[model samples]
Target: MKQFNTTLMAAMAMAIGLSGAPLAQATTPDNQLVIATSLAQVLSVDPQQGTEPKTQEILAGVYDRLVYSDDAANNTIKPQLAETWEIDNSGITFHLRQAAFASGNQVTARDVAFSLTRLLKLNQSASAYYKSAGYNAQNIDSLVKVIDEKTFRIELTDKVTAEDLLYRLAMGISSIVDSVEVERHVDHDDYGNAWLRTHVAGSGPYTLRRWVPNETVILETNNRFWGDAPAMKRVIMRHVPESQTARLMLERGDVDIANALTAPDVKSFVGNQAFRVEQVKIGGFYVLAMNAGRKPLDNPLVREAIAYGIDYEGITGTILGPYGRQRNVPVPEDWAGAIANPDWSFQPEKAKKLLAQAGYPDGFSLTLKTIAQPPRVDIATALQANLAQIGIRIEIKQGNGADIVSAHRARDFDLLLPQATAIMPNALGAMNDFVTNPDNRLAAKNAGNFVWRSAWDIPELNALRNQASSERDAGKRAELLTTLQEKFVAAKPAVLPMFESFFPIVLQKSLQGYHTNLWSLNRLEHVTKTK
Candidate 1:
């Protein structure tokens, strides 16, 4: 193993033009934290435009939301820019802390108001939450108001509960920006969307130093930050997309942390004292989405047959291994309002019986679309094998993640294996994504809705989602959510959730205080490195 690592490091050095020079030191600089991760999905760093998880992780350090989840469980709320807040039926009022932007502008309620107004005006992917809550560009300015230099208020619509709105505000989409700094670069009435794509106007503990797309991202400490200063002076995230390459770089001490390692690579560091493997429950599920718009799949019995045919234990134990575990329900078990595990298990006989009832006694052939990446490809292969046992023939077709997702969004696939996560850390978020499909028409173009992508439209589930979203009482909300999940499982929806994902990350032993949460908001401000 040692010899293999050495050979790998040498090959990497030669490939990257470091063959003739001294290789990177075995120990990284004491004041810097280097990370190797895939930035393929990170198209923009703008808080209002960047929707990818990688982009959210990067912005977490450079920007501050009004509030933040206290921990991975997302059970409590903590203040960030807002020192305190008061929630009531009509709206929420926030008391802003006396802080300064990286650009030296005072952090004020007006900036918060403008940031939200700009978010709605841009109408990017980040605006989905606010739009769902009944806010739009025309009325957003009136909804978000500045009472004083330190006070901000956001009016609530009848469609959403205060708790629901608060959870949404804690997300990266609600990140407060420096209104003065951003407005200076507005172009063609774009509301600084064009400039923010490449630049950051936040007041968090880090400032964007340099960004070369798909190559490297550099962040330096923001000395003017009002909160506790970050221990690491600088952070450098290098794009290392391949798991093997990231493992080699991490083993050689060229990087301090590696994100998105395969199960095999993660196991390689299990007993090594020099490295630590950490897993965070990201509250997402790996699901098999059957396009109901396609014939045969449109029948509920056929969808149930597909679900029964899956070898949940086999896949979770082998293919997923340490990466994930079986979770049949749409809502993750750790989250609030989750129902007890259902009696869904692998029973080929039951699957065959259901198929025969659905008028496919001879079985049928279909195409399965999946992302060409770790675990996903392997999981798709496992699904193919399991379904074949029940007389279903699955032709596996693979593509890049983006292409596969584009096809799924277009409802152009018979079966799609994709990992779906809640936009917020709440059951409502999951229901909104996996169960609510207000309009099922192709002309609706509701690409963001996963249920719509699967072409599953159920008015009863939609009504339940609305009730749960607007329920103010915690007890009543929990009951409503429980009923929602029960009804979803009973309906045998087109989306069959297989496992809950536990995101695995590796770090050098010398690194400390590195934390991650459900939204991938890995704030590096608290991270420290020892040499």
Candidate 2:
């Protein structure tokens, strides 16, 4: 564990600009792109192990997957390593293009098979992505097969659909590693797991030049890359976690990009000529969940009462006005099969009635937990006032963000405000949270099922999610998803979702060809700081 002492942070802070560094020059250089952002939740570049936004942000440039979202639209996936692919004999087959690693070795089907197999065997957090797609240690060796140097096949079980595999593959977890290089670094059947975590051995356009964990990650363009090299020859990712410091770095010419800007700053930059800001609606929706496995909330009526008492408009329009909008369901509004504008809304009278009917003429007392962040404080305060009218005594407990996440996973709180999102824009991927209990527990391997502590299980709902994922007809799949959401809403097990919020990335006005690729790396191939 590394300790970032005050003196060290101050020194790095000076180097990156928060400590009286000079402001930017009129134009940014083409050979360099500097970014100041927070430390990644996890910095391991290993495809089989890492699972943080920062991890994907950096690794996206260093690894290639079979497919990718056609563009920043992120609504459709297109082939990358596999130029052409099709469903064949109850399995999916990919015909690889002639791709070469940075080391100039041709990529083969054997490399792809080895990469997938390594994940399954290691069973790390990244392995959960493939395990959710129905490949486990028991059958992974048989399911992933190489037909030739250029052909690869994945046989799916009845539980996993071809679409599910495609959606999962497009994510960072499916990043293809160079089998030839990784073998040289293998240690005690660890399969280079320890070395890969800190090294780059992929065929992507950028090769890591230096990574001083918790400080900086410097990448230089791979001149030997198989494709056109990134326009920005060198990218310096400096660690500047403080929002104010990152802003200072960006305001100066010290960095080309500053991410996670405060909402007020993001708004201020909107019409500014010198800087441009991008704030896209990602799937990290803000919601409240109740403990269905515990006392009073185990009753659906109580959960319903809590839901109806929340003021969605007050939270989104007031606290998060510039940053977010109200969202009714778990799936994001624009994603495929999203159930937009559902039957539920904030109703105070209905909440009072439900509480009385639950045999609690006087609303019961319970604690509401939230991260100590200012936004969560605002939203929880709003919720407290709304629920008081219905006789509910709300006690607010604020803790660290990481601690809150652990509590959610452990089912440690009575009521908690947490963000929920489908790992990607997939319908089945979103429902993996609430539908698992013990009976239909297929997607439990998927990450971030925070509300799962309630032990809520519905066999029918699980079947519906599984069925909907495999449904080829978009209309039918959408209908099934609607039914699932309606069922969950009716049951009242979750902390009712208030709104979908957003974060901002600030860049120079001349920085072109950049879009928010939410689930993968922030691609920098065509990005150039303009004059």
Candidate 3:
């Protein structure tokens, strides 16, 4: 067995070792914390499109939203930017919090107005968020109405659920910025503290100090935050993409925390005495999407055949491990309106029979594009093995995370494994982005310009979705969900192989006050050094 060492644990080994001698006198033992992660670089700190776990982890420290989900309390939206608000016939109104600030100025209704408006106007790379937030109404024309400097209203163009706007605020784009700063960068869709992409100016419990990509990022406690300061004076996050390396670092005491350790590695951490591992089954799901516009896949019978061909049980059990939940439908059971379909059973014989009926006695050859990351690789391999049983020969194509996403967007592959962590605490996000939107659909990810042809159009399905979106009554929404689920399995939008794999966070046993939210970063604000 390889022994874990501090020098090998954190990628910032040289900096942490050398910088310590100079700052030793000023630092208290409890004032410093180090996090080890499986990220190559800090992709983007701007919340608009920062969907990766690492970005969310870092942003959670450097930014705050209008309302935040209390992970400990069943993911309830607690007040952050707004103190309270009421929804009347006119629209939803929010009473702004008086003490919030981004840098130095007070966070006002104008900032909220600016943030919401920018999301509609900028067409920044973050524009993908609009699809996910269900603000599909072009330009978000019905999004907001500023009642005053301290109050704002969101008037829906059509009857819609509060869940839609709530999820939008929860997204990174919803993090308010100074109105003046936003104006300065208005021409630059990438603006809002361009300096913040590498540095930060938010009013969260922590502030960015230094970011050296692929090496380390350092954050200091935010003195101007409206709430209590973070327990640690400084936080150092080292980018270590290798799972074994992260585990070794945690074991050696070089890194105080290690995130996203795989299932096998979780067992190793549990066997060790110095560390503790935590996990949550979030709303993320991995899928094998086929091109609906191309030959062999254009037929609905073929798509349906492929859907029933794979063994979800074997895939989840072997590739995802014991904790992983098998999903028979596109939506996870944990979501509010999850529609479970028990009929989509794993039947390879049925798949082969369907393929024969679809014109090919022998299954066709196709390519599978996926990220080079371990989880994706695992899913791809499992898919390959399962598809082989049904006579389909798949060529696996892999690349970096960003490259894979770009490739998908460009329609570069025949089949692709794409995973999305839905903007949970709100299922409407999933509906808008994956189900209804054309751009976000799986076939859109293929570089060949292949579109996900929704041939299984059921008027009942559309009606249920609309009902779920417009109904204010919780009972009616639940009833709509039941109707939707029944219709969805019959249409087969996408295959849900496994429930979300658990996001694992391993930490030093002595670190106290740790918390993880399903939608936000693990709350490190109240964390303390128990030792």
Candidate 4:
């Protein structure tokens, strides 16, 4: 491993920044860390569609949830907006923290209530009260009753587990927002929170300073932050779409950190001594979601054939090289519900047999929709090649992120290579988002419309998921999780779930104290320039 003394590298970078020889050098201040990413803007902070990490960064700064899954500290739910809470026989009661708001208003229980109501209106999956009670936004409007300025009550329609409710609350969508600001722009009846989407007023560590659409978003530190003040003065998230351009910026000392680097591009800095690369295993799963409500997929054998046809090990070894792993289950190993099942392994012979049984000896051509991402593109190519060996012909249709999402929702294509995101740590959360949740646009519905046609239905699966949610016993939950994973594997509703790639933050050696957690929450606090 070729390496340089971090202290020496920091000094050199600082000297270059101070000297101001070039545009990249001059713009990157001693305290400012410029990070580049290819993530296009789908900017709705409503946690229902908040898949992009770029959007998460902005949300992390502008919002504060009652409980944050602190990955930097053993993946525990640390106190944030609600410092702590107590659960009695009646219901859970949160003790509000006195935090300064961005709008200079006092943070209270009313703000929490408003935020939850907004989340319900937006139909966010992260709303724990809704999910546990098996309620939607409309259900929320009826259930939540404000007790006092600091206390609230959720009367469950049915009996709910205490743990399930807590986990749901820990999701990012449950973040508190000011009620007054919400009502200012929201009409009595509207599906969207158009005003709060762009303009934010929350009690977080940083305030949204500027968002120049497709170019860059600048944020400044919240001086009256409730917790420890961040060491860095500001954070600049530059939208550099090209990986080559981002790589060039990092090499030239123009940017401090860059995320979503390609497998080959990472090789450039693996041996370079000027920067430090930190790779974190983000909690997500890459899947080829099939429209099960459609013709061929409606047949169980065809779905199973497609599952068997995927050479997961081959893709990881050849296409992904060192940047990926073949994951069987949707959840990560560190998570609560990762199943250990060897039966779900790839079997080309079984795949071909299933195809023949499904009355297709020579597979038919189907359109596979994907974004213009290098990883997905590579995966598509590999899948096409592998499937061809078993007589499955796949035609690739590439488009922009928004276009792909539209097509996916419309059910225009046969298959899609989109990732599944978890609202919380449990397997139930993952299952609920992808399989159970009706409002989830990417779920069982025929395309984006609410025509449920996914080839999956199980009272047992549903019961297991519900049981896992409220079950307080760790051992029992794990056992139930394994059973649920088996059910999914047996009836491959989605394609083979692949392991998430670890995102590396390549930054100048001078920056320190950056933190990342299991949930992939990147905190910019404690990051200081020593040189």
Candidate 5:
């Protein structure tokens, strides 16, 4: 059905025929749910350090922030740890709910204060959100204070918008940790990262049962969870890298959910009575990232040529099908300040003219590297064919997701095809990494970020991105976003997104309450299996 890498497809074909493998028929308990996916890298479970999508999936279930919001709830502020919050002239003070950590430590204001202080002290992957708000090593401890056991306060150095602060605190990176639990595991300068990557310390619904690196991660429901108990007592996340194998496992009743099935793999199950397939449009965006500092791509006209050269509709219609949408803006089309379905058609003559304008009338050759998958390869082949007509000698290279992503980070490739998951639903969430480029040392903590690799230093765009948070006025903020997109499009800033795509989440018909947001976050607390 769905096309994958040729080699992987062959292996899957073999595995499908050998479905008699003991694992396929291993009786699944009704109380246990098995999930299959391709994990990129999960270095740490510490909310401040986990960076990959799989890491987010697990951490989202294993940790809880002070406040939470989702698309269905209109991204409005909702209480989680902090039951209520009040904003004042100086700053905002949050009233911590009477909750206890997995370790049975009553989550007091000291724990909250300690968690925020630790996050800033580590200055790991997600501290950029606070760093942007003017917290650093020196003053972060001084600014954040505690008032008694129930109240915690975050006093800011500079003025900030409530909208920005709310969403920042709502993010997974802001998940509150058990200060004492983390301290017990901290190693020499490691800050508990090595331990947290494989363990859990938050007050969320699930606790880590086991994590076998690239093989599997098992999560058992927290019996002492502050909220309602989870329906599935155990969530088994197995690393089945091949889509066809995952599909077969689902058909064989081995796993309850198959997260990374190929499109064709999903199509064959169209009318099946036992299984159901869902292609949810998450907050992930694909882009053809170029090193703006490099040659040829450095030319504005050349970058613009490549931008006009992509056949967004043709490839999306064929390879992507209903699984992806073609949109021009970074944010989802439904959100404000979003521009949808713009005319980025296949234009050979225009591309040639732009190339000539950039002093490359004969066109130039460059290597385009992407994940070695059928759909991705098909898209790259389409681009190669389309640009060839304009005298561009494009070389297509393929690798696993990790190899390609690592190469992009090193500036070792001419172009790379990658996807970015939206941290939040808004425009700021989509482009935060682009605007908040810090030193490589800071970025290494997160790893696999393209903004730092592009080596772009646009102060104007940075200021504009910062302005959206401070502006506060909804209409004026939208206007600022419109102008920002216009400038980014005009500049053709290294990243050229072909389309926004979705992935299929196949499961049994009886399972309910497994809705993922634009960012592909599914809270598994309420998922129930009637069958």
Candidate 6:
């Protein structure tokens, strides 16, 4: 392994505003794993509060859920904190293994019960999963109960099936926290929400050592972890927002992994012997969401015209390259309910005719908001050109992912270009956000629901979504969802899905056993480094 100069390490530490002792060594140590990626959207590490991808990745290393979805495409899961579980018509019972937290406290059924109860009590974005299953703050105590010291039970509601419920339990929202440690820090009945944002209290392979906002996050191996010990003693995640900078650092061996590389940078290391480039298909889609409540977009004709005007083939082939593929359907193709090759094509003439029929021979102008990142920015520029061809003028607005997401949540944009990922592996995860909008009122502030954010309300489609979610038979549920998608496409809904994403990552050749699935649970316990 290459070693870095002491002066360089000191200088770099000072540049990122690190205080106290200077970095002793700058080299990639055998016992340490260094990753370079953008943490711009990571606001909190709390499992219940974090909704961004980066935050979820961090929490995956620091906490363990009762169950884990190892292969989301196949809809399969494996036990994590819970050694085994049994399911009946009423509810599911989990048999937890004998484990201890980093604080040396025993993991008990009470902790499991309390963790779920706390999630409902906090009423954060993550609570949406439980809420959909009919587990609310008022009903959580009875629904989630402790059977014994090592046994826990969660009653099922008529709103969801046991199979769908398992997928939800596998998500980060169901991560089990050390209740004793969290209760100790609770203040003013906040349920440790304030403290957990910056701290971690869980029984995973790694524990939070230090976090420096948008600069860095350091994690140390948990000595008391019940699972297999991690190969690296420490994992250092540095915030390198620029793709070129991350690429340069990876080339110089300053980091072992670079996750935020652009398509061009990723291709640069394609066949290099020193690096291995991986492209994994994840469950997400790049969408162009139109505000249905807005002026001209309120008409279905306008939304259909906008959808027809997009050059899906051009954008996916050029800008996306190896990063994504064109997918018109809202659901990911790998999921069970996904439609196979729905009827959609790029026709500028068709779009113009629709616009003319909508009483606008001369297309109106509107602003399109998008994240200021590679592919997305490039995609937006392509969309701008495509719409202009049909007489519709599109003004492009760019900002960081956090700012763009905030604007979408506030319902403050005409059109939005953003990637939407399913919270769970189940098809309901995507339908819940993209198709269902329980409340369309602006005062509801339901940022979790993408349909609500777009001000889209279709009772017929919403009714089908509800039926699909509650159907106990898998085959019947798939049929219902297919019908819902067919109707959704025919209605010209506000959200237009352009392409599905494929996450590309570059890692050192010496790194082994690193795996990430559709949900982006970057588990590191099984990973090792060869010096």
Best by TM-score: 6
Ranking by TM-score: 6, 1, 5, 4, 3, 2
Q: Which residue pairs of candidate 2 clash?
A: 24-252, 24-253, 288-495, 289-495, 510-530
Question: Could you give candidate 4's per-residue lDDT for residues 1-531 as a string of tens digits?
Answer: 112123322322333445666443433787777888755644565443354556777777777877777766655677777777877655677877778687778788877777777666665323433654565666777767677876766654443555556655666566677676666676555433666666677778777787776678887888767878886678888878777888888777678887756667765565455677666655567777777657677678887888778788878776664455777676676566677644544688888899889998777777888887657888999888878888878999888777887776566668888766665556665555344433333443423221222333444655666676656677887787778777866766644466555555666666677776544446676778766
Worst 10 residues of 2 by lDDT: 1-10
Candidate 3 off by > 4 Å: 1-29, 40-42, 100-102, 124-143, 186-199, 271-273, 334-339, 343-346, 426-433, 438-463, 494-498
Backbone-clash count (model 1): 0
Among the numbered candidates, top lDDT falls to 1
Q: What's the TM-score of every candidate structure? A: 0.89, 0.82, 0.84, 0.86, 0.87, 0.91
How high is the lDDT of residue 60 in model 4? Answer: 75
Residue pairs with backbone atoms closer than 3 Å in model 6 (clashes): none
lDDT of 2 at 474: 73
Name the candidate, 2 or 6, with the larger TM-score value: 6
Model 3 score (lDDT): 0.65
lDDT (Cα, tens digit) per residue for candidate 3, span 79-108: 887889786764678998776554677877
lDDT of each: 0.83, 0.72, 0.65, 0.66, 0.73, 0.82
Arrange candidates by lDDT, descending: 1, 6, 5, 2, 4, 3
RMSD value for candidate 1? 5.1
lDDT, model 2, position 234? 88
Q: lDDT by residue for model 1 over 26-139, one digit each (tens)? A: 767888999998776677888987766788888999999998876644447788899999987699999999999999999999999998998888877567667666777899
Model 1: per-residue Cα lDDT at residue 267: 74
Count backbone overlaps in model 3: 7
